[model samples]
Each structure stands twice: as C-alpha cells, then as structure tokens.
Target chain A: MSEYTPLSEVGEFGLIRLINEKIELRNSSTIKGIGDDAAVLEPGEKQIVVSSDMLLEGVHFDLTFCPLKHLGYKAVAVNVSDIAAMNAKPTQITVNIALGARYTVEAVEELYEGIRLACENYKVDLVGGDTTSSHGGLVLSVTAIGEVAKGESVLRSGAKVNDLICVTGDLGAAYMGLQILEREKQAFMANPDMQPELEGKQYIVGRQLRPEARMDVVYDLKERGIKPTAMIDISDGLASELFHICKQSGVGATVYKDNLPADEQMLQTALDFNIDPLTCIMNGGEDYELLFTVPLSDHEKLKNHPDISIIGVITEESEGINLATKHGNSYPLKAQGWSHF
Target chain B: MSEYTPLSEVGEFGLIRLINEKIELRNSSTIKGIGDDAAVLEPGEKQIVVSSDMLLEGVHFDLTFCPLKHLGYKAVAVNVSDIAAMNAKPTQITVNIALGARYTVEAVEELYEGIRLACENYKVDLVGGDTTSSHGGLVLSVTAIGEVAKGESVLRSGAKVNDLICVTGDLGAAYMGLQILEREKQAFMANPDMQPELEGKQYIVGRQLRPEARMDVVYDLKERGIKPTAMIDISDGLASELFHICKQSGVGATVYKDNLPADEQMLQTALDFNIDPLTCIMNGGEDYELLFTVPLSDHEKLKNHPDISIIGVITEESEGINLATKHGNSYPLKAQGWSHF
Candidate 1:
C-alpha cells in the first residue's frame, strides 16, 4: 500500500528543490535558471521580445477532457505563439502555476513533464517561475522571451499599400474540434454508458487539443530573405487578427472568399453542425496559423509555397476591410472574436 | 439601474483596446509597451534580474477585508522584494491578471491605479501584461525586472561562517495582523450584526494589508559602502529564510532568541491571541523585511543604525542551525515556513 504524503510534509522549500532539480537550462543567454531570488540573463545586441498569457481551469480548459499534460503543453505553446507572431526566435520562458489541494506531487510532475517536452521541442530554456496554492481551480501563466535583430521584427503596423496578404496552413479545424469535444461531453453526461464518437474526427480533435504555433513559417520566411511587412498569429480568429493588422498599419484589405483555406474535415464538420464553412473559416478561433503581408515585389518567391496561401492585397485606408464572395459580391468585414468574460 | 455589458458585446480585441488606452509607458528602457505581439525593452550595460510571484485571491488575500487597490500594490511589492533580495534596482514589471465576470471596468481601473502608484513610487515601469477572464477567483502574477552590476548581486550561497547575521525592521507584525483579521472574520460570520472591534491595531493591520518591500535598505547599504555577503527577503519567516541561506551556503547559524525583532503592537497582539511572541517572530511569515549576513569587519557600519539589528553569527556546518535562548539554553532551529499546498 502507498502512504500518503501531505504537501505540508515537505513544505515550500522542499517542493521548490524537488522541482528545480529536474530543470536543465539549455540557453547560454540564461546566466541563471533557478535556485535564486531572481534569474539573471546576459545582455545582447538583439532587441528582446516579451509576451505573457494566463490560462484558467474551466475557463480556458476543462479538466474532464483536457489532460494535465496537454494543458501544460498548450499553455506554453500559446505564449510561444505570441512570440512567433512577431517573427522572432523564442529563447526562454517562465511558468507560474497555482493549484488547489487536490493536486499531488506526481500530478505536478506530469504537468512539468509536458512543459519540459515543449521546451525541448522549441529549443527554449525554462528559466524561473513561482508555484503557489490557488483558492479553487488551477491557473497557469507563462511568459515567453525572444529576440530579433534591431529592425527585423515584423510588427502589426508595418504593412504597406498593395502588400500581398498570406496565411499559413488552414483555419477553423481547432474550433470544429472544440465543438466535437463539447458534443461528446454532453452525450457522455446524458448517458453514462455511451461511448465517445471520436473515430473519424481525429484531425479536428488533435487540432483543438494540441495546436502548433507556426514557427516553421517564420523560419521559412527568414531563409527566403523575405521579411513580412506585417504579421500576427490567428488566435482570436482570422477576422479579428486581420482587423488588428489593418488598423495598426493604417491600411485596408480585400480578401477573396475562395482564397480562404479550410481543411476538408473542418468543412464537413461545420456542415454536420449546421454552420457555414465560410463563417467558420473567418470567425472561428485558435487556428494558431501565421497571417502575414509581403510587398508585391516578393510575391513570386512565395507564390508556389505549398503551405501558404496569398489571399488578398493591402488597399488604401479609405477602402475599408472587405471580403469578396465567389459570386463577385463584397461585404465589409467585421471582427467577431472569442470573449472569455 | 446599472447597465450590463457582456464581454461578448465588445469581444477580445475591444477589451484589449479598453485596457491599453489607460496604460502610459514612463521608462526610457520601455522601447515598446503594448499593441505589438510582444513588448520590447532596452536595458543598458547592467545585468537583468527577473523575479516572479503569483497571488491568488482566497489564498493570498481575502477580498472581503482586502481592497483591490491594496491587493494590486501588494502584488507589485512582493515581486519587487525578490529583486531587492538579490541586491538589485527594480526597473520594470509586467502584471498578468485573470478576473471573474463580476468585475467591472471601473474596478479594473482602480486596481491599475494602485499598480501605477506603486510603480511611480518605485521608479519602475509598467511594461507589458495579459488580461483575461478567470473561471473562479482572481489571480495576479507579476514579473519584476531589475538590474545590478556584475558580481554585485548577493545570492543566498554567498554567506560565510563567522559572518554577522542582520535583520532590518521588526518581524511577526504581518502574521499577528492576519490573526486579528481571521478572528474578526469569524465574528462577522457568526453574528453579521456587530461591527468589527478593530481599534489600536492599525499598524499590524496595515502591515498585513499593504506591506511595503524594504527597497530603501538596498539603497542605504550601497550608500554606506556595505555589501551583504548573502541576503533574502523575510517573506517566508525568519527561521525559514535563514535555513535557505545556511543550506545554500553550506554553513550554520546561531540566533539569539532575545535578539529576534518584534514590534510592540505585534507582541501585544500575539499575547492577546494566547500565542508566544517569540514563536510568532520565528515562524510567522510575510514581513517583507530584509534578512542578511555581512562580514564582521562591516558590522560597525550597521551597528549604530537604528533599523538594523545584528541578531546572530554564522557558524560551521557541524554546528547546525541553533537558537540560543534567553534562559541560557541552545536548541536546534527548525523551519516552520508557510506551506501553501
């Protein structure tokens, strides 16, 4: 029989020691990782980029369907996605977690295992963090640090008129995956003996559970010597992010409805749910795809890229943001992003 | 009647705009504040020190007695105290907040008002952050950035045998204050009629509600040309932090029981609660005072200082950590730190 060890047995310092002993720092920029009041970093010529995000249990995730390991991975991935949206290379991260009394030492270890795996996959170092108790649910907040050459970073404000709009991969799969999960959860609640019908929806389910940040697109653009005029990750939805770029860059855009990329599985799932595929592609959130703009002169280099689609071109500020239908009709775009309040 | 605006009415981007409009970056190092994928900073010459802390609403604070403004101020101060423990000058901070749906825009502004006040007082910049909704309670995670010259930072591993152990200000006041608050809360719950019997407990109550980090001691030590060998903020009780220094530095310490700092109000409150004052000084937490060790040669510089008290001396590892009682008995000291888990 296993003996129970209350967290009070080891106290705060012992818990910190247990966790810190397993952390291995890989970045040279991280002069100090843990076991100190603060972590220290070496100065460099490149400009540093910092982004943070907080995920709450039951709000950002449901423990019933979201495993602790996947939650940890998603927390780090989302913060890293913010850094990647600036077209920079992530170097270090700090993760702060607050857990209720229900968590065990082994459970926290599993969460850290996922965090460590993400750090290894992204080549980012885990520098420092705080672990404390929560009143009720779990809270995970991650801060990502990255670097870009003095003027090489692509901000949301740099797009110019006639710039070609580009996006990586497809959209709406993650949103559809969430719909499937919620439906399955309701079915299980209604009938305890019912099995989850997740057989043919693996693609969408995986997309929702473990969305990957488009770091590959960032690297590809760098290798091709093409700097995006403006860039942002599709997190709150394609429509909202596009509006951010347009408002910040003081320009407007006209996107072709036919050019919007949507996976076949996502379209089928949207049809099954009685939702328009175009609406899903435009307003569904958490795609984690890279949406960027490149000058007209650099169009040829990206025209044949398999994973990228040139969907529109930047227009004058007065033109307003619009989506042109396949029927040759145009409608002004309105941002319908996710709200967590 | 108050109008209700569902967060969905404005969406995520609109909420971001609402918050960003109130932020004004004041530090020159804050090259970029918000609006981009990440905030950018330019720290010159000095080594950057990063410290983080998370405050959960029912764990770290009771909103019933703690004002939101004070909670915000306390969050920033706690993180700043960590930087001060490293003998660094705090320069900037990023605050991430997750609030429930019951919060209003005005309430958030009040919290920021307190944050801005603390930042202005400390000459620190509010650089960046993330704001989102929480499912249960409020959570605030702050990362403070500071700078110190190379080789000037004092880590817990730098303490040496025969060094003078020193503490700044009185301990146990915050803990005693907490006891008073808890008692009052119980009374309120039982009757819900009698007014809170708070009188002449202002000092301790304030200490618990809005404790200030001793950054002044850091500046004064530099001015006096006195560098501590090792240091840590007394946020986790004196005995517990001393254990950290001893374990990390591979040494032992002997503190005099009579030398423990205790405020008059704290002693009275402890007695009123039927608890020993010395025990409160030993194991009660959240004082935000400075506990440090200095070479014997430098003791004279601080000996005459009113706030600095030399409580003990470092010893060899074989001596173990001990406390010499006023009754002429020596006993091994055990850390009874706060355990959130």
Candidate 2:
C-alpha cells in the first residue's frame, strides 16, 4: 500500500522503537522491557532457566523460499522450545538481529511482525535487545528466560528403569517438508517458469517453515498431574534425543518403529523423494516436539492422551538403545544429527 | 608448541565440550550451567537484568590487527558494560558464535581463552550458548544476565534539573587508538619491510583493541554511597549519549569542553593525525566509559573520587543541550554519533 523505506532512513534507534512499539508485556515478572540498558525481571519464587540460540543466514535458513515473517517466528519458537524442554514456562526473551545494507526497514518490520506474533502466542515478554549492522546476511540471536518451580524441573538425567518414553505429535513431517521445499527450489532454479507442485502438501510444508514449540503439551502434562521423569525437545531428531536421555540418565531405551507417529503427507512425500520414511522419523531435525519420559506408575494418567505417543521404554544401562521393527527385528539406534559446522 | 587442530576434526560437539571444560560457576544462584537445554539460576531475593549484543565481522571488527582473544574478551566486556550501566552486578553470560570453515579448533580455543579470562575476572559464570557455522565471517553474540536489589537499578530517564553529570575514566583514547591502527595498516600495506612504530602507542592502541567496561565505577559509586540518578555507557561518544539521556529524561544540560578528560597518548596521537582532540572526545565512539548523573546533594561525596569527573550540570528542559567552549562562547551540541549503517 505504501512505498518501502530504506533501513538507513529509520536508523538503529528508530528500528528498535518500531520493534518495541506493539510489544505488550504479558509476563508480570518483567519489571522493565526494551527501553533501558537491560530488561529487568523479578523471579519471585521460581527458579530461572536461560537459553540462547543463534541462526545464521545460509547456515540455518534459505531466504529464497522462507518468508521473513516465518523466519522470525521460527527463530523465537526454536529458542522457546529450549526453555520448554527444561519443563519451564518461558517468561521473557531478548532478541538481537544483524542486517545487511541490502535489507530495507520494511523487510525488518516484516521479520518483527512474525516475532511479535510468536511472542503473543507464547505469552513471553519482549525485553532488551541490540540491533546492529551485518556485512553478510541476516543473523538472529535470541536468549529466552523462563521459570520453573524449584525441584520440580525435569532434567535429561532423571529417567530410570521402567520409565515410559513419550514423544509429542508426529515426527519426520518437517524433514519431509524440507525435502519438498528443496525439490521445488531445484525445479525452480532449473527454469524460473516452473510452478511448484505443492498441492496437498500443506501439512508437511507448514511444518518445515513454521514449526510450533510443544508448550501446549507442557501445559497438558501439568494439568493431568503427570510429571515426566526426564525431558528433551526433539530438535535434533528423535534418535539423537533418545541418545541424550539415555546417556544423561545412564540408561538404555527400546523404541518400536510402529509407535513412531508420522503424518500421512510426510510418508507420501518421503516416497516421492525416494527416501525411507523411517529414516526421516529417526534422523530428521527441526521438529521442535517434546520427547520426554514418565514413571511407570503415572502411565495410566498419560496413556489416553490423543497426541502423546508412548514410543518407547527406558531399559537397563547394559541393554543399549535400540529400535524394534514392526517385523520383530531389533537394531541399535545411531544419532546422525545435523552438523551445522 | 603443539600443532593447531582443525575445527572439522573436533566437530561441533567436541568443540562445545572443549569450551565448557574449564568454566567454574562463581554465583551460587547458578544451579546449573552449560550442559542441559538451558542454564538454571535461582535469584532468591534479587531482580534480574538481561542484555544482549551482537558483533559482526568487518562491520564491528577487523581481524587483520584485532586479535581473536581480544575480540572474545571485548565481546563479553561490552555486554557486561550494559549490565553495569543498569548498576547491576553481572552473574552469567551465554555466548553464541558462528565461525566460518577457515577457523581451526585452536582458533576457537584462542577466542575462548579470552572469554574464559574475562569470565574469571568478572566473576560471572559461563552458562550456555550456541556455536554453529556462518558462511561469512565470524559472528559473536553475547547475552549477559545480572541482578540488583529491587528498585536500586539506575535508568537513563531519571535525570532532574541541576543533576551533576559525571563520567568515569578518560575519553577519546579509544578513537585515537583506532586511528593509530588504521594508519599502521596503511603504512604496512605500502611498505611490507617496515615495522610498526607501536613503542609508545601501546596505551592508545590497547584502548581501541581491548576497551574495558566500567564496572569498577559502579562498585566505586556503591562504596561511596552515591547512586547515579541516571546513567548510560559511552559507546557512541559523549554528545550522543548525552542526547539519549536528555531526550529520555526530558531535561537539558550544559557541558564544559575544558572539563573533558583526554589521555596523554590520545592527545598527542590526535595532533599527529592533524585531528582536533576535542572533536575526538565529543564525537568518537567505542570508549565504553560510563556517563552518569548524580543528585547535587551527593556531589560532595562523589567529587573526590579518583576516576570520577564531574564534567557538567543539568539545566531546565527549556535550556537545550549545549557545549560551553574554553572561551566564553557556548554553542548547541550536535550528536553526530557513529552510523553503522
């Protein structure tokens, strides 16, 4: 509707003000936000948890297909996911972004639009941040601060023998989504006139571009009075997360292939890409789902949940982490996670 | 000496473990650091302060003369300076870095060496961070967490008429040091055989390469029982920071040019470059000095401090910010701060 304004016209201070203008503090513990040298908070009776994540341009995302708004929302969601993994409710986040001269003020505003939306969705306060220039592409770094009740926070090292290993929602959808996007990108590069064949692929495509953090499941578990024995977010694939839980807890796991949830579109897309859907479920990253464990005694409380899938069970340390096929063969799981470096 | 190790040889996980090995938690509030999904802290009775900063290669630093270790140390110091600007004690920091493929494991370790040194010196714990790959140059983003007694944090919007404006340490040296470095770089390019004439220029050079945050001033003010009514760090020079305080506080001020502090090396280097030292003091950036305002009543207590200098007095809102010359003439001050864009 209007002409775009260059970032140089708005300057750093103006950009910061624009980013903070619509940010309403959702967390009461946030005493001050985004004006002074730092954000002030008073964590009255809760223990605080802090986590940070950095996303580079080419290293983390490709701007050719990823919308700036989705990129912004994904950045915040991923950091909030880390806080959720700690069984803590995220309260505040400080976001820092570096932009190249090629970016306009409108482009930055588009990115912040997604950030604001995610902040509202998560009910986290937008706190202090620094906006600086970058010589390369866009860089977003977010530090999330959350709080959990003392001694109630679930850790990766707390799983014990007979603990039920659970995962939230479906796995491999985002991985398939990435595959679809990559294939479309290749097709588009081969010829600029080719239309993307994305019909009926919305379920998997959305998972890749706009993955939601499993905070809803965290709330669900609390409401049902089911405390997980151990927890971790499924960012680095299901198999790698299983290794984290097993290694930290000094235990082993046995996950059944049939129990791993997969979206129908994800399976179809995996076949289209000539890849095994099982491999996608185990090794595909960027799911942002919760993979946690519960004590056997609390199994009755969690067994009937619609979205929660009891994928596996914790075993003795000597048993080793393995995946049992539907046909009765068992194989040790390997964590071939993403190596960004 | 041992040969340098390639970063690829160590991979991301090994590099993380290498960096986390020597970190010791100094704050009792840090329940957990650098292992799980997030760092855990329990700030029992204090309010928390959070700040973040991002430094991009070529945009914020030059590696030709800037040592990686100093870069690492300066990155932490600059973020900690923001916490100190709020009159809060820094407790923990999460450092996120993106290194290119050219970097070796030893290079990352060198950078961490400075970070470790700063963490030890500042008594802040290295909590958690994300280290990945960047397609361009290095990127370092640090988020510092600090704490203060409730209602004791200083802000930039609290200055009143007649508040004594003060600054810690000498100014203009950092700007001059940058000038020296740039000059030497040009000379070296012209004559590869010539040695850098850095014998007496070490003070000014060090000021530019490794500026220290003024946490000592915060401690000094507390010990002297004088709290600044308003405060800001001099990252973008004196006049710009003065404008920020005045605009935010809804007040005006007058500063005397003669009262500005200049290091001996800085003054000489400025003249050698044929640039006026007064201009460097007023408009030069990246000094990392603390500029603050104190109530007139506490002037008697703070006036005798060794590093603290009372440079000016705040005036009524109608009186506009002005700079009084060494002569009887006064002129309106313009804040031509650094424009990174």
Choose the strongest candidate by lDDT.
2
Candidate 1 lDDT over residue span B73-164, tens digit each: 99999989999999998988888998888877667767887888788777888777888898777899999888788889889999999999
Over A1-341, each residue of candidate 2 has an lDDT whose tens digit, in order, gives: 55888888888878878887878999889998998888899999899999999998988899988999999999999999999999999999999999999998889989999999999999999898889998899999999999999987888999999999999999999999988888899999999999988899998989999999999999989999988889999888999999998999999999999999999999988898899999899999899999999998988898878999999899999999999988999999999888776
Best by DockQ: 2
Candidate 1 matches the true fold with a TM-score of 0.96
Q: How accurate is candidate 1 locally (lDDT)?
A: 0.87
Task: Give, for candidate 1 chain A, the lowest lDDT window spanning 10 residues.
Answer: A1-10
Q: What ranges in model 2 sit over 4 Å off?
A: none
CAPRI band for model 2: high
Tell me chain A's TM-score in each of the predictions: 0.96, 0.98
Q: For each candidate in the order shown, give its overall lDDT on alpha carbons.
A: 0.87, 0.92
TM-score to native of every candidate shown: 0.96, 0.98
Residue range B47-162, candidate 2, lDDT tens digits: 99999999999988899789999999999999889999999999999999999988999899989999988888888999999999989999999999999999899999999999
Task: Give interface RMSD (Å), model 2.
Answer: 0.8
Model 2: which residue pairs collide? none
lDDT (C-alpha) at residue A129 in model 1: 90
